[model samples]
Target: MIYVDPSGDDSGPGTVERPFATLQRARDAARPGTVVTLRAGTHRLTDTFLLTAAHSGTVYQAHGYGTPYQEKVVISGGREVTGWTPSGDGTHRADAPGPAPRQLYADGLRVERAALSLDGHTLRRTAGGYTVEGTGPQRWDGDVEFVYRGAYPWSEGRCRVASVSGDAHATTLTMADPAFAQATRLYHSVLTWEGPGAGESYGVDSPTSVENSPAFLTEGTFATAGPVIHYRPRGGEPPAGVAAPVLETLLHARGAHDLTFRGITFADATWLRPSTPQGFLHYHGNGYYDGGALETVTFAEGQGQVTVPGDHASMPGNLIFEDTSRTTLEGCRFVRLGAVALEFRGAGAGNTVRDSEITDIAGGGLVIGDGARDHRVENNHIHHIGLDYRGSPAVLVTGARDTVIAHNEVADVPHAGIVVYEGRGTKVLNNLVHDTMRVLADGGGIYVSGPQGDSHANGALIRGNVVRDTITPYNFGLYTDYGAAYVTVEANAVHRADAPVVLTVWPPLEHVTFLGNVWDADPGDPPGGVVLKDNTTVAGDAFDSDPRAVAITRAAGRRPARHRH
Candidate 1:
């Protein structure tokens, strides 16, 4: 056994009376089958703490399990900012001299960045960059950015400002190198869409908002210069504590097995790669391409087909477990993170994440990538994710095999709730997903694309989920798009969506079955090679009182989650 406390000494023996100061010291002193007990306090990490193959069969737990006095444990990757002086304009200034983080927290609440909406401005694409109809931001410290939607409703991209000039009638904004060229290439790549409203498929072309500028600083926002950090107070109240993320990875392990982490909270980590010169070029469902130029553009037989190398790379997770097996995380919390919360990658098998909470992130929640098998994620609460990058889903499963994602509550996201793209024998069952696609479009509450094994053999199953309140412009309740094949969607209840189910016919879905489902809106027609059997449509209040819908809603989302105070 080993013990760790935040107020203890590092030179002491790892005992209950005299504990080790850091987790690293207790981990180094532990054996293979040891239990490392932690006292209740904050353990702020400057770098990632590691556990490799030598630390198999280890358990990290709270100070007292199954007791009344079990307090909270926090493992944070944030650095506290001191010496905050009042700037006398209802603002505060601190001496922070580094790359600015994408997220900030004041007294454990998320703070918004400085922004100005450009909703009514006319922005025309010029040779260098763009020409705005009104006067642009003229007093920036060289890191002003534009968060804009592309021509496709499913895409969102960002770029930096190099210089801004011209008169009050129109200002010419010059974009930064390489990122501007890469974003323009992706925006003009989609040339054809045969399905509904082909001519009216253009979404917003101009930027909706400009971020990270001093000119846009308001009463509830914060901004950063080269060596100074500026924050405007909300309603003239001073904050008790202020912290910003500094490290990227909080935990990274490879080739380990049989580990457990219980009753802990991981918080405040930042990822700065998206703020680089490459920028963020979002595609769909956690796939982003930053590889400068398109590999191939073929207009021969397929007009809008651009060949990526392997369907683009996914965003890296901040806490990664590679080639690990038989791991478990229960009653944990992950908050104020800048990237994906957890990832299982590279020959991983038989892992489980249950009864946890993941919230307040800039990227996706939980990602099980390729080369993973037989994992289970259930009974968790995930909310308010994709706060910066709007294209990421709450839970994304791609190219994994035999995964089960069931009985979780997912809400308050910008994109899809759960997305499965090219996985085999995966089961998504009994989840309660709502208020999704709150910003972007063309995704659904639960979406599936690409093949999932053979139709006659082990295929995919999406069963008994309750999805509701998808109020986006172009979205569906249950969607199967982009050449999806070999799937069964059964007994699900969908309400208040654009449509119940959107089965795409462009790439032409094949061998898909929708059986015994309940919806508020009727799916007009089934596409070719798809089957719809015994589905019922209830209108208005009648849908809420239906027996099948009542049973499914009652059984879903039993566990609610809370943040660590």
Candidate 2:
């Protein structure tokens, strides 16, 4: 057994009396079944911790920690920013370590990224960015930046200033060039957050157009001016000390089987990969592939403990286990990061993430699969996710098979509670999902989209889950949108929502089944075009209400489900 203590030394022999100071040291010294027992305390790392097949453990043997679940062994990516100088306008300035991170925290709460906008004046859209009218842009320090919510809910783009020239009527900001021109096409639209088109959007022809115009000064805003990060508190409270994330990822392991990460709390990372505002998560298919796979983008470590390959690109997540099997994360805590808490790449198989709590992040809690298989995500508590970025779901499982997502509690998010897309033989059972789609307008408590032209979700089962209180126009307790196919809904309970089940497909769905479910809703809740079977509900249609029934009557050869009028 190897020992690790936050207060220990690196040069020591890693004994319990003189434990290793860093996880990397312990990782380097690990062999198969090497129990790396961690001493109780915080472990703030300055670099990415990697483990490979050479350090792999046996299929069922525990290789990592032997600590109790109550032990607070925090793995943090943050360093407190001291010497905050007050300019006295209810704001403070501190030297930021360059290139700069997108999110910050104060006393364990998320601080908004700094944004500048006019009271009523809309920005003029430009190819590079929007132009700030009058004195608004003129007030910014030279190091100011502009970040916009992406056209898609799942994407965001940020750009540093190439130049900011102020005229009497306007200040035009020419954005610095990005590493990949693909990014230019990725975030062309500035999404409207609320109002006329709450979720509607239009391309930004002028860099200054107000698409999703963020009303000025409601939340905390921040920006870096050269070496300084200027911050405005949310409600007149200056931060005791600014907390900036110094690491991009907590742990990165690929094709390393039989590993276990237990009883550890991972926190405070400033995930930035790719470069600029569009991290590794840009549009696939030449920047227009509907936001799922993040495979093509190459990532390299950069200055801010982030990895942005070119001059621009940034994407981050807490943990990445790719091309591996039989891995497990049990009794762990993941908090306060800019991207997904844990991500498993395409080759990710037979991995399990259970008995964990993930919260306070700008991105999703767990983003698993992209054609991966047999991943089990169960018995976890996920909430307050996508706090900064609303496009991410609590759990996004794409094209993963034999995956078991059960007994998890997901809440307080802007998008779907749990999204299963293009997966075959997947099970989403007995989970509790609520308070989601808070910022987004169209989504589901448990959403299933895709099985696009290229893929199909065959033999998928969504059974025994509880969904509630998802407010939005197209939001439902269970939604199968776009082109989801071959899905089954059985024995589920959907309550307190505007709609219980929705089928808003484009070309329509196929081989879908709904059986023995409980939907407690008001009158006319299901919204029509539903074919229920052997089920119960407070209101709405039954068996004949199923859209598949319409499909059966429409054509002889198993026609597609019809749309609701």
Candidate 3:
């Protein structure tokens, strides 16, 4: 067992008596199964500590030795070494002014080369020294030693050059020929110069050119590269792949038998970058092939943003479980996403998602199926989604089997609340769907459609669901077509200002059952036949001789039965 303080004096024996000064020293001294405990405090590092196969079983734990709240540990990157105070003088001197400060400059800091981590202290720049203010005996701030130096083109002109070297380094800016600064004022710009070595300059309207070129006022001559780029004055959009900087995802698993995360919160400002292909978390195609138990993790994106590209069919913040088995997600939340929240794809089986909340999405919420089988979805809250396009449903299922959806609350979606297409043995029960079609051309609460030749969805049971406040140009609470068969609808509550439900079978339905349902609005005169037994319609007149339509006598509290027209 070796102790690495990262901030302690290096003169000791790397133990309690004389501790090692850096994390890398402890990592180098440890054996294969060693546990390195990092004392709680900000331990700034100059580089990213990449763990390879050799460090597989190595446990790097950060624990507080003193007050729990006061202990913190942080690793950082890309810091520049300033002047250090001598032991006798007890005063510091400037070391070549380090990197140029940004528009806002605060000093008295520790600089490193690569990634940095801060623990148990607030990191804020100050005039004298970087303030690591909090509380605890284990609190300290120091930078790990690493050096990375890269050069960019320096055109002789009046333009501000802003550059971020690597990770955990602040952006630095310098004005080229500061006297002529008025002729060129840079703002959120990047300039690329093709010379002996390709160099780049970044800032607002910064300039770069080929060779040791004196800076010239050349318009549209510089290009920049990185994760983020914002043009000023007119305030143009960021480049395609740019996103806010933040540590993205964290995972904890117990063993190879598949660890499960039931109720976890994943929150960050840059959870999903709008112009980039980054979500908070993604787990797809990492599990068993023969439907073995895979790792299951649920993310509640609390006040986070997720972006998906416009050209892709899938949405952002989506969790796709492909060819996995026995995974479930319940009681999660999603907001401001580009696509569906959860998608089961490519022969995935035995998955379930229930009692979750999805909102503010550019696309619809839940999409199960598309080569998935034997899934259950129940008791979810899906609302306020699908602003971009039409025909986005709250729940869409296609090519699935043995799926049961029940007791869900869906509202304020664009197209249909629930849609089932091309599958078998699906049971939808006791769901409350309302306020659908805020932005759709035509909408329905429930729509079931099948493929061209194949009969759509056999042995489906839709019962005891409530449909209300669906206002669309072509509205229907429930519509089934495209050679559907053997679907039973019973004991449902539907209320609409317009038409409530429409049962249209193009090739005609076979063996469909409708029974014991209460309709506030009628299906008109002569409701069709299958089995319309024990049904009560609020409409004044009943259908006459419709094969699928049944008449029922209304009682005070008993279940209605189908009556012959």
Best by TM-score: 1
Candidates 1 and 3 compared: the better one by TM-score is 1
Q: List the residue pairs that clash in candidate 1.
A: none
State which candidate, 1 or 3, has the greater lDDT.
1
Residue-level lDDT of model 1, residues 383-458, one tens digit each, is 9989988888999999899999999999999989999999899999999999999989988999999899886267
> Model-by-model lDDT, in order?
0.82, 0.64, 0.44
Number of the top candidate by lDDT? Answer: 1
Backbone clashes in model 1 = 0
What tens digits encode model 3's per-residue C-alpha lDDT throughout 417-487?
88887677777777878888554433478766553122324477777777767876667776655455667
Residue 432 in model 1: lDDT: 96
Off by over 4 Å in 1: 133-136, 166-170, 189-205, 292-311, 559-565
Q: Compose the digit string of candidate 2's lDDT tens values, residues 1-565.
A: 7888889999998888999898888888888877787878778888777778987882211224342333567888888877777665667778765456667788777776545543366776566655766766555554444444433443333445566687788887666555123344544332233345343234233222211112232347665554566777767786675688878777788778888877778888865542343333332111122232223222122111111223222234578887878888877789988778888876867898877889998777887766678898877889998775566788887767778888788899877788877767778887878898786656789987655223225467887777777876556888877556667787777766767877534445555667777676532423233345776664444533444433322221111222110
Model 2 TM-score, 2 decimals: 0.78
